[model samples]
Target: MANAQLKEEIIAYSKRIGIDKIGFAAADPFVSFKNRLLEQQQLGFESGFEKGSIEERTNPSTLLPEAKTIISIALAYPSKLKNAPKSKKGDRRGIFCRASWGEDYHHILRRKLQALEEFILTKVEDAKCLSMVDTGELSDRAVAERAGIGWSGKNCAIITPEFGSYVYLGEMITTISIPPDTPIEDQCGTCNKCVEACPTGALVQGGQLDSNKCIAFLTQTKDMLGERYRKKIGNRLYGCDTCQVVCPENKGKDFHHHPEMEPDPDIVKPQLIPLLTISNKEFKRKFGRISGSWRGKKPIQRNAIIALAHYKEKEALPTLFHLLESDPRPVIRGTAAWAIGEFTEKSCEEKLIQAKNREKDPNVLYEIDKALKNKEFDKIQG
Candidate 1:
């Protein structure tokens, strides 16, 4: 009964500290989750981005030996960007996903968890606590699910009743046992909207995801995007929101609870051409605060070139030609070759041929050859 009172105090204090939602969970091993993860690994569905081994991921005891409860918190982010900029003809712009819109959630959630840890220390002097954000071994989604923060939507997002699936989740494991909240009932029902709406079909069979096919994951890749996914990636610069955006539960669900979570229209939807030429210092100065810049500028630049091709911006041809001839990175040179080939320019074939002759790297040469083929096909169609 004393633990129950502590739970109430924690929940109340959490709200006072700007935590949008909080829930308690018993520090038990996620037995079924471990098996499911193993299955995902066996079926090659795992994204290389996961942080820990299966055992460490599913076992809370490994984090804190005397762990008795896990406290999960969620902070909602806005789905709709207010006064979003237009992506017009000569000034086409690429997009960073909604999750990357604001100041990085990792920092925000970490600070909140730290505050909660300090509060808990005051209540129970002997309590041992460990907290982590997305980078931590424990799965944020799994912890949120068990703690009843929200149901796991078909898109693999934790869908809270008040906030939809746009919430950032964090957790703290503690030796002090708190009463666990009942898990929210799965409400996805028979609707497969997210699966059907996914452009790359990354959401395989509802909640399970094949991250390789996920455009969100592909956008963060430093290597050239797979040829098959290039056209489908569209104008996405950082991540894909097709699954979440199409969720019926998320319809008309927009929140601006945290000021820091708000997006700057021009930054998130910046003109694509300037992105290709941004200096490292300039990129840091402008995008340094957002979550999208974590992977550095190379991938974003590559995707921007692909976005230009997707838009078929004829005005960008001159700049693309410059990148094809001079970019130091092979991925950039190769992607530029691919985008140039995608264009209907008559000189594209000749330019690709010249690049192929000068390019010593086999991969870049292959890209050039592929572009030349595209040029021939484009000419035939014309």
Candidate 2:
């Protein structure tokens, strides 16, 4: 009875602290999730960024010995950018996905989870709790699913009825045994929108994702993007929302409940060329607060190179030449070599030839070779 009263008080406190949705679940082992994760590993589909081993991820008890209940929270973020800057022909802008639009969700969710944890301690002195956001050993999606926070959608995102898939999920495991809430019913019946709209068909089927083909995962990778996916990524600087953007459930689901969750028009969609020359300190100062910047500026810059190439912006030729000649990163130099070829200019050949002499990395050399071949091919076609 006392625990039941504590649950109500905790829920009230959660709302006051700005948690959009809260749910409770038993701290039982996530049997199905473990099986799914093992299957993903077997198929080489798991994202390498996943935290902890399979054993540690699936069992909440391993994380907290006295754990009895898992408290799940979701904070809704804005789906639309207000007064977003346009990407014109010459001045193309790269975009970070809606999830990366605002303040790093990890920080936002952690604060809310901590508040709930404190409230729990206030009621139960001996109460023990462990909280984590996306980085924790426990799967935030699995905990949210079990706690009735939302249903796992076809895009492999937890889709809340209120916030669609635009909500950030986090959880807490507590010694206080609150009764578990029933899981939400799956509403993805007969919906194949997200799967079909996937750029690389990364959403193989339903909830299964091949991380290698996932543009969101690809965007975070520091190395060169695969040649086939180069054009497919378009101007995405960080993360891909193609799957979520195409979901029918997310239709007209824009939410602006939190100020910090709102996007800065200039930051989320910055000019592509400026990003190429942005210094390390400047990049951090501008992008440090957002989740997309977690992978650092390299991947974003690499994507910007790809975006510039996709645009075939003749204006970017000088910047591309500079990157090929001086950038320390092989991916940047290689991608710039490719981007230079995209521009049909006489100096492109000479610039690439100059870079070829200086370039030592086999991959960069190979890209330069490919670029030259493409130019030759274009000449033959012309």
> What are the RMSD figures for all models against the true structure?
1.3, 1.3
What's the TM-score of every candidate structure? 0.98, 0.98
Clashes of each: 0, 0
TM-score of 1: 0.98
Give the RMSD in angstroms, all C-alphas superposed, for model 2.
1.3
Q: Which segments of model 1 are wrong by more than 4 Å?
A: 375-382
Q: How close to the true structure is residue 307 of candidate 1, measured as C-alpha lDDT? A: 96
Per-model CA lDDT versus the true structure: 0.91, 0.91
Which numbered prediction scores highest in lDDT against the true structure? 1
lDDT of 1 by residue, 84-193 (tens): 88999999999999999889999999999999999989999888999999989999999999999999998989999988898899999999988899999999999999
lDDT of 2 by residue, 5-115 (tens): 888998999889898899999999999999999999999998799988999999989999978999999998898888988899888899999999889999988888888
- lDDT: worst 10-residue window of model 2: 373-382
